[model samples]
Target: MLDVKAQSIANLRAQIKAIEEDSGAHGRSEARSSQCNGNASRAQRPHRRYGTAIDAQRNPASLPCGCSVLANSENDKQRFSQAKQTEEERDQANSAFAKIQRLLCIREHASALLYKRLLASGYEEHIASEAVQRAIDCGLVSDERYADVLVRSRLSQGKGLRGIAFELEQADIDPHNVPAYQEARFRDSGPDELARALSLLAAKPPKAKRVREAAYRKLVQKGYETDVAARAARIFAEQHDSVAIETR
Candidate 1:
């Protein structure tokens, strides 16, 4: 009985040792599986430091601290600002052109005059100049034509060539074109200067006691050259004396 009891006690000790070994082995296997699952989860998770996947694709030079996102936003803002400024400039140019058209419709203007008008009406310098150039290109404005018309008008009003030339210069007519217009109108198709001067003197003779001097002064004031004025005065005085003698 004592031997059996000792054998049973030894058997129970062996079974307990076997059970403890199996539990330890199962725990080690479960620990390894848990470690593998954790590694996989970490590998599948996205990195938050680089922003979204799309953002990373767009900016390959992205920094770890996310500075690339700010740079991209700034670049987008700059592009938008440039586009807005371009649109505003285009609108201003169109408005300037419309103003020029209205001014031309009312009456003729020299290119310089038109530009000045636009400035006086508060248009920007570049806008005014562009509008004026457009008008000139489209044949709406012409310095040559303006000069010619002014010369004709002044002549009809009994203004001398020198006076008309000065007026043309003031009106911004080109210096080269001024002489051309003068030669065309006076030398080619207009009345002789001397005849015009004499005719003026005859119509309105001097009433002063010194007739020749007075007539010369009057003709000079009317824009004739001194030489032409003197000759016209002398002829008029002689004609007056002869007429007086005939009446007596």
Candidate 2:
């Protein structure tokens, strides 16, 4: 039995030696065949492609072609597909960013043009209304506080309700709020209003035979009623001379 075992071992060794010799010869033959076939051409080289055979072999599903430079397994295919999808998503995101950047480059000038056209054309009254709202939201303007300040300033400058209302209307302010602003901002014998009216009378005393006519026109332009202008003129005359007032 011992001799038999020794013989078997010797036979195995001889078989391995023969197999190694045959493998070496086969490798030489394969190299010769590759060279003769011009497989190493610059264009035919694996480097010419984007990914190596190893990468394809690792991700067979992503390869799209049945060529494997890498000894990768089926599991690698799923991973490669996921990675490719991620790359695509990133590229799309980059493209979107570029588009937004281009649009924003002209955003400021476009916004101004839109505002001018909207007001001038009077398409819907506040054509840039949406833009104004967005501006306010973005802190470019304030509607509430601005309304209060503007009304106050106009009233102080001797502008009557009619004049102020007209101006505010032109500015696309809501009419409903205009009345409220007028009521809140001015009252009977308002100091600001009285001062403004007094200034108008003082600027040029009605001198022409059209003196009264001129005063009336001025008062009307200032947004005062005929009655209010007459009353103010009478009161003003009593206090000073050469100052005439009338209303239309």
Candidate 3:
């Protein structure tokens, strides 16, 4: 059994030695053939070169295509970045514009009211200001126009001059434009102030004792002048009492 084991060891060594020798001979043969193969490859492909740094002094053409590819890639990257930036800017501007347009469509607004609304809606001050300015430049947002509309509308609802004034002030209107706004929006065509006050009293009686004093207080609360409201209420009560006495 010992001799058998020694023989088996000898056989394994011989096999390993044969493998090494065969590998060495094959490597030598491949080395001798590689020179001819290298020359043939170069002859067939003179323009092509290899390696990470093919633009070496002796291999200029090796990376001409690579250099051009890199340049084109860089230019494309820059152009794409610029396009993205421009699109974002345009989108922001459009968003601001849409918000302003929506508000205007709902109703006319004074410049101050519009600006405050924009700011309250989370718009930046500069953007809101720009939007308001452009609207004004386009004649879309005007304090005077807003005042005129408001005054006329309120007058129809039985609001007196002082009532309209208070409303305009609260809406941040220009006080200087009030007189012009009143003249323009409410012409002298309708019933006089006194007549309107009488009509209001007829429609919605005051909570007072149906006397001039009660009417005067109600008119004052509705934004009438002290003297004008007192006179209107006095005249209205006198005429009403006369009619009642005559009917009785």
Candidate of highest TM-score: 3
Candidate 2: residue pairs that collide: 53-69, 53-70, 54-69, 54-70, 208-211
RMSD of 1: 13.8
C-alpha lDDT of all candidate models, in order: 0.76, 0.58, 0.75
- 137-214, model 1: which lDDT tens digit per residue? 889888887777777776766656766666667777754577555473448555677777777878888899888899
How close is every model to the real structure, measured as TM-score? 0.53, 0.40, 0.53
lDDT of 3 by residue, 118-234 (tens): 889877787778888888887877887788778778778786777777778888775557874457336677676777777777777666557788888888888777877888889
**Model 2, span 42-126: residue lDDT tens:** 4445564564564465445655544454324556656668888889655544443343334445532223333555456443333
Comparing 1 and 3 by lDDT, which wins? Answer: 1
Record all residue pairs in model 3 with backbone atoms less than 3 Å apart, i.e. clashing: none
lDDT against true structure, model 1: 0.76
| Model 2 local distance difference test score | 0.58
Tell how far residue 20 is off in model 1, in angstroms: 41
